[model samples]
Target: MNELERSVLAKIDQEQLARLCRQLIQAPSENPGGNEESTVLLLQSLLQDLGSTVHLQYAAPGRPNLIAHLGGGNAGGGLLFLGHSDVVPAGSGWDADPFTARREGNRLIGRGATDMKGGLSAVIAAMASVNQHAPHIPLTLICTVDEEANALGIEHYISTAEAAQYLACIVAEPTDLITIIGCRAAANLQVQISGASAHAGRPSDGASAIEAAAELVALIGENKQKLAAAPHPVLGPATWNVGTLKAGHGTSIVPDEAWLGIDRRLLPGEDPQQVLDALLAAARNRIEAAENLDALKLQIRGSVQMFMPGFLTDPEAPLVRQVCTTLQDLGAAGKHGIWTASCEGGFIAEHHNVPTVVLGPGEINTQAHQPNESVSVSDLHTAACAYALIALRQYETSQN
Candidate 1:
């Protein structure tokens, strides 16, 4: 590495990165509680210490988004590093306290350690290093809220002037250092089936909503098989899962109401509205064709609870090429690929038409939302170097 490159990499303090990651993980920003105020404040303070301009924007009460900008002489617009402050709830089943960040060998363990606290901390460290060494590198750091849930923070950001002015964006999602240039869309479906209630002994007196729900589940499974046959080349296939199902309260009574929650993942070029409409139509058709006829007094309804469209950035896009080149320079895999999971990168790419890439430390499978979540410290250092290099490269390119 050249002297300047070595200097940038050297400035990435490993201890500071670990400390910051631990602090972030210790702060609870769980989505269900909608509590990100403390995390937001922590980030704000960190950015302020670096002499960056910080602003707070709220999508809801106690849920605030932080935007920090480091001015530079580059004329090619700004580069945005997008990350979320909010994390999924730390469910039961853990060997240690989920809120306490612990260092076990090379891994730092905590609730948000890998999901993105590590990535976020690395980016912040890189930003600080870049600002000190190369002040001309224009950078924007967007620490958002609600990414684990509805992505309200990102939704609120795209409408701002800062998002519109950015040339490209890098989403600091855990990718195990593999660069992600595209992602599949995601949506949640809620289906409710209602039927007359009756005692279990009177089998002929009332219809069972539980049975109707099973029928709908079977129908969805059949449709899922059909969808699996036609897979997207990059994203694979559209998939659905019955994440939740609820029925009657007691065993002695026939279920009068049932609820099913389905999580559907879609590929690029698929219309979410059309997909929902098709699902509803299919369910209605199946219910109408049932052999029981009108005597059952059954009703079915389905609605979409959430929808996030898929997006793909061209491999040749400036941002993608830059990241791939940086990864290669760092002796890492520079190949561009698609992320099966949904992230805010797609939303930014789709809404702002900005070239975006999801690149960061940690593996999605082993770390995100799982018990004893952690990220490799070595990976964090590598990501810090990559982020600094990318920012410097963008700055140099802008000068030309």
Candidate 2:
């Protein structure tokens, strides 16, 4: 690595790093109405102070995306570090206030602590360090809103002309410090069942949509193993899940409508449409055969809509090799492979055609999205150092 790169790695400030992570958790950009205005502004102010040019764009009225840039001397293609500012709502079950960004000993506890304001903070801290040393790599930091709800902000950014130039990208999601070369695609789907409603006394004259929904769910459950068996060279198997179900308003009346929400994990070659068709076919068969069915019909509703597709990068790809070398330089073991879960890897690789990977602190088994969510302070410092080293490697490769 060059002198500038070495300097950048050495300048990381641990206190400021932890502060950024905590502040983001405290901001409460929860998915229900995901407000990232304050969070974006915080990053914008910091980036501007570090002599980087920044821009804020919106997907919806209030939500914003912050992009900060630092140019290299000879830029063929720059590297982009992307992550989201929004987090899922912390519903009732917490021992500590989920939005308070509480710190107990070495762990930082909050809604976004591990899923991942911690990842975002690590990258930002690395950026601050790189800025002080005058970076040799052309770097861009993209912080967008709505990742927890939908990816509207990132989808909007990807559709733009100016965002297409990057050669590679990284999404700083929690990964137990492993290098994620690929991720399965998380495709959101909805199934609706409709039937005629009647009073409890006259149940024979009416159809129960709730019953049809139950039958449909049964059909899906039976086929779960089949769906899970689809093979991918890298991603291994696709997974299916029914996340939510709702039917009926009261006990006296038969439900006329029922809704079911599903999360399908796509392997590299699996088509979302095919998955939907298979589900629809199963529902149609089950609905037509069920007892007490006056009339049964199933239809697919709106989906996640922004699926870019699953992706994998060759271990020998230039960017991958560069990152590996950098990690080795930083005293890491330097292994790489595909992760079973989904992340923005699909977006960066499929939408932008950029070589993308997810590498960060924290362990994959550490109960993210569960109560007592937290990240290790030791991992935090280590991840910052790793990101700094990776940034330097990209610059070194570009020069050669």
Candidate that scores best on TM-score: 1
Model 2 RMSD, rounded to 1 decimal? 2.5
lDDT of 2 at 367: 49
Model 1 misplacement above 4 A: 73-76, 159-163, 292-296
**Per-residue alpha-carbon lDDT of candidate 1 for residues 305-355, written as tens digits (9 for 90 to 100):** 777777787788888888998989988888788887888777777666777
Candidate 1's TM-score reads: 0.94
Tell me the lDDT of model 1 at 298. 84
lDDT of each: 0.84, 0.75
- Write one digit per residue (lDDT tens) for candidate 2, span 173-262: 888776788878878887777777789888776678788878777877777777566577677777778889898978999778888888
Residue 108 displacement in candidate 1 (angstroms) = 0.7
Clashes in predicted model 1: 0
Residue 338: error of model 2 in Å? 2.6
Predicted structure 1: lDDT: 0.84
